[model samples]
Target: MKLAKRINSSSVFLVSGGARGVTSECVITLAQQYQCKFILLGRSPIIKIEPEYVKNYFDEYGLKKSIMEYQLSQAQKPTPISVQKIFNQISASREIKNTLSRLRQAGGSAEYFNIDVTDYVSLQAKVTHFSAITGIIHGAGNLADKLIEKKTEQDFEIVYAAKVQGLENLLSCVNIAQLQHIVLFSSTSGFYGNIGQTDYAMANEILNKSAHLIQQKYPNCHVVAINWGPWESGMVTPELKKAFTERNIGIIPVEVGTQMLVKELNSSKATPQVLVTSPVFPPATEFNLELKTYRIRRQLILDENPFLQDHIIAGKPVLPATCAMSWIINTCENIYSGYRLFSCKNFKVLKGIIFDETFVDEYILDIQEKAKDNNIQEVEVFARISSEKSQKVRYHFSGEFKFLREIPSAPLYTLPEEQKDTIPPWKDNNFYQNWVGMLFHGVSFQGMNKFITFSQEKFTAECFWQKIEAKQQGQFPVQWFNPYALDVSTHPLGIWLQHFYQKSALPASFERYEQFAPIPCNEDFYVTTEIKSESDFSTVADFVIFNSQGKVSARLFEVTFIRWFT
Candidate 1:
């Protein structure tokens, strides 16, 4: 388990609802690990002395009976509600004292405040004095388990006020600039609505959204709303636990739940909201539907796609063939949830988009479902793009998409033995300067770092994986397939054509392409191109892209490039 390096003994943490239950368990873990100072807040007041009758009773049933007997001896009527009230007060005080003692034993100091967090004036007055606080864990929340129709207005207020209004009051008093971390304890009910937790779900969802908004304003602060699933402790009663077990919903252990919070704080990747649920949750099942053709209209302009300016051919911007393939995969993935593109077959560019003249009408992407197998969790779809020109449809590109339930594992790749007669490798700058003159790709697409091996039949090169900004990726941003990396991997083939045939070439079509994993950006990877066949008009080849570990990430089979003669 990785620990957060940023947290130390001197760090001061402010936690709400931290004197008892699951929150107290987490507080103890933090104290044991970091030995930090904590300010714990709760609504229960400390009990210095226990009543004589309740002192001897530990269990709830015994305590209730003892309280009722004491009330009878006092010549008073013992109502059920009055007996339950005294029992609750005794239980809360003992829990709070046990938590405080554990914190001290774990080598941490703590200060407890008995105040309702929903009371803004009192909360603000107490919080304003804490100038040295470094982090905040907003874990205060109440649950009223009643259906919407049966619930009263007071029930909703009690649940919502602790989470929503409490957070507002805390933030209003704290110094935002002095804080380094803000963790909101949201719930899975907020993410996936639950039947009897309407008020709870609404309050938690507000916390999730607030985390995003706060992160945008304070970019340096680590803000995250963890939508945790049901846990083994806290509000889950025995009856509720049995119900969850019958439904096959897994319960997170107290130790595992606290450790996950530490891991989340240590992660370098910043995500504003995340759902942390156990693996026992049910898998997604396919929805039955009738086969239908869906058409999406889109208009491409040179001003919108600035990266196309780098892909100039004959003084005109031309869309790379890789971008067209990305459109097909992204569209299909968006249509269905819990499905990913497994492979694309028979991808052909009949008439590529060239900005020789501005178009006045929108282009249409037509997708039709060909087949679906729910048991296998696979769907086959055919996609095509066309535009109406003078009342006639001019087809641009077409392909077949296969979406599967899971992404396949990356295949192993071994570098082929080099030929003895092959020339020494060319440095990146020297080869790219000559290659770009023929291919006309700009800096954004120029990813070749070094040419390692070259021969008549095969060649290998190391290419830098450049990161594309969201703004520069155009309307069809890189999702499943990165257009820039794919385009750059084909550079060796372009160099081969220029070296032997003295002509530039463009990708015409490919028989099949498979993506096992996403290509990592801002790193270097190896590209190996093997020439299958060559002709005067076109060249057919296979390309394998892999990392330094020799794990094949993607492969293009029987890719045909049409030679250009000008």
Candidate 2:
């Protein structure tokens, strides 16, 4: 989908905390690029005149000394706190003036208002006067860094209200239809929890989730929450920089960070939540521990996962077999800190999960480490899941996962020869509608775009990998293996069975599946299924998925399915 143009000379932006710090740097960059109008909101009042005593002293040391000396001349005690307050006020005023001056030099007009975003009445009144606001950037936030045990109620309020409440007030006052873009500046601390930023993390997570909800409500507006790491400028002090260096965490440069913001604003992609951090921040896992078994339990309900409604079979919702494999792979990958799934061996669906009269509510997944080779950075894990209703331990699904430090390259695939003249060509929509009472999948599960070729022994089809949102994925979001795309890849085999034997089938097991890389959404790829063996009650086939360039993305070997007599 195409997005509207972001900004122009006539576009007016309402920016919170835009007078100074990182937000100020972004405003300056935007002015230089687009020459747009900006309305800056801050807590610092615009001071046109400087005091005579501190006017001549521009340096910090000189200014502090001058303020102390002037206080003594007035017969008042110059405490350290009082002197520091005056010094801060002077510095803030200068920063604001410098920002306005730089914007003017860059061919942009700006106006600053001394309004505390936390106060809804004051923020609403100020926002009402401006009716041309086409965009909003929520960059206002406060830091009260303290350990959770030592944190106070006031500290939480100060830090939380600045981000959560500030955005709420802005959204409450602005005209929702007029806005073209909305950007929320979040922190990586929220994405990955931090030690002393409990309150800050909680506040920023709200922003991240809010972006998703807002984008769903207003499809016309581009809303995004960027979870940013520490930058070279802004809140990173020299002492903190030293700490980050010691931990091998890289800091983002000011120029690079601002440019990323500009790119996000102009991009057409509709990802509402993004995490931008240094690659080194999440350190690699060191596997030197003993083998262990981990058990995790989850409650599964059909109502909670709305996508299952689309996967109805015989008027009953049933979990797709590919989704079961996804759970196994995702569970294994998340066990280690930095490991990724290389392949799955011997994946079996012992019993299908159908939401019939007797529905299973809870399931337990057990992952046991079977083998590890530290020299090659590879580990083998066995995973299985069982339901609570069964008296005996009956596993519904099971698989063996092989994880490696990095994914290996996939071999090139040779396209199979097609007998196009033998079988009549079927349109995309017609195939889905007239397929022999076998295809019961709804829109979300139907990914087969068109049939390239079809025969009794083998077939090739083009599948459209549409993007599935988090809410549609049922239990979890799309991680390593996209269940929808992988599920659709098996449609060719199903069609072959229905056309020849006049029967329906469901996937029962697979000998192996090797994944070279993740399949991207909003793209088209080809899946070719070739029959290996066939019997009265079962069929075995091999599936290969490749791009237009003939590079294989994934391969499934010895895929066996149980045929049902119709």
Candidate 3:
């Protein structure tokens, strides 16, 4: 996870659950950091009431005792239900004013609205006033603690309405296209399940699943559901607090809890549902979950697979690392249930698989779910190639997959300036095929459209889907990390050596490589390569694939290319 871009000052945030709870605390911190406007929502009513003051009338006789008596009498005075309601309203208004004051002092604006989140019509009517809401923090929920058998249907409805219905209503009513951040407050009860929190757990579980679905739909937005543990706040009764203390389950301090929230907001790779809790608690596996795995094999042939044929080195067809990743990813997709692969870490190509007429081989793929902690899962992936005669297996590709609950929002990247004015566009129609020595069929399928700039130290090329009739662009099985597109990204390396080295060269090995994010198939990319070092035997370089949004989809680091000589 990279450092997350901070919230813009122009953006407005909406926080539910009220002006004086955990949600409000998080909003106040965000307000201070970004100095953005906020609209706080709750179901409390507003009423005008002033602080009562006492006027001294008489008596230097027993002055201290008399004043104490007067105060005691005022405090003990009985009031009707109507008067009590007014007092409650006044207290709520004061709390809202205090919250607003704090935000204003920190150079941000804030407003409070009295509306129930479960009431869609009222929420919609109220939300229209804040048309520029760029983020939402939905933290409204109720707690009805009871054993499963003793729990009432009404109890379930009340708890579910706050989180499940509240989230549904917000998602249905809001302008999601404009939203950059969507944070849902979940709980450990929902994630691992507790004894007396059936409704609460169910509601929070809905939040976690909802975040996963929403993230898949909106990959560019930060959709997070934070599953928090118990905190030392108004919600915890004295008996409950004692029980927790006895069990050694530490209650989260308000300051610490808010800080964790801020940390989540600042991380670019935050998982969809982050379980912000202590390590001493019960493990998530207590709920009994099954791990997912995929196993598949494919036969490769040079005549049928033109991609391998095009990527030849020293008169022998060699499989590219990107294609290996494509095979693994595609296999995972065939058995995919709910999880989606987002980022690849520590990716490396160990050996090169050379293909010849006698190179009839089978490629095997396996992706297994390994470790499960909180809301994140670690998947181990492997792709191997072998033949019938020898038991020798070449493990061509290996990487760890971080399955995301919420997709990391697309980043705003700085594009490298194209030096097109100095370098003329390479306008040869069959440039990759004729000049670069790559086969025509392979180049077209890989979506190599045009060259932007090429030089010794730096190179930039453009890749787009071909508009030609009957030409299929990006036809590879693995569309998420488009190995064809990745191959296109490395086209400059091939062209640079072909133009300057006086000999055709193929990439034999890569020293190291990593992918920050998955490459999207639809967008046209500007592949930028920089020469880090060069010698007669080998050339090492780094390259980045920037999408149409000028954001890097994949970055290859310290790629050591051993020259292919025949």
Report the C-alpha displacement of residue 83, candidate 1, in angstroms: 11
* CA RMSD of all predictions: 5.7, 5.9, 13.1
lDDT for model 2 comes to 0.84
Q: Rank the candidates by lDDT, best first.
A: 2, 1, 3
Candidate 3 vs. true structure, TM-score: 0.46
Candidate closer to the true structure by TM-score (higher is better), 1 or 3: 1
lDDT of 2 by residue, 95-130 (tens): 999999999999999999999998899989989999
lDDT of 1 by residue, 1-566 (tens): 22223777898888999999888998898888889999999999989999898888898889899999999999989998998888889999999999999999999989999989888888888988989988888899998988899999999999999999988888887898778788888988788776688999999999999999988887777888999888888888676676566546789899999898877876776678988875332234465757778899988877878889888888888888888878878887777755778788899998988887645458889999998878788888999988887787888899998888767889998765545357544443556576664657887788877666787788887788688777787776977678889898998777778777788778889999888877656888889999999988889999999987888879999999887763
Q: In model 1, what are the clashing residue pairs, if there are any?
A: none
Which structure among the candidates has the greatest TM-score? 1
Q: What is the TM-score of each candidate against the true structure?
A: 0.77, 0.75, 0.46
Q: Which parts of model 2 have CA positions greater than 4 angstroms off?
A: 1-11, 32-34, 41-102, 112-135, 142-158, 165-182, 192-196, 209-224, 228-288, 373-377, 388-393, 409-424, 427-429, 451-459, 499-503, 549-551
**Candidate with better lDDT, 1 vs 3:** 1
For model 1, what is the alpha-carbon lDDT of residue 78?
Answer: 98
Error of 2 at 196 (Å): 4.6
Q: Could you tell me which 10 consecutive residues in candidate 3 have the lowest summed lDDT?
A: 279-288
* TM-score result, candidate 2: 0.75
By descending TM-score, how would the candidates be arranged?
A: 1, 2, 3
Q: How well is each residue in 332-394 modelled by candidate 3, as lDDT tens digits?
A: 544442334565556666665677654545766666666544445333343343334366655
The positional error of residue 337 in candidate 3, measured at the CA in angstroms, is 30
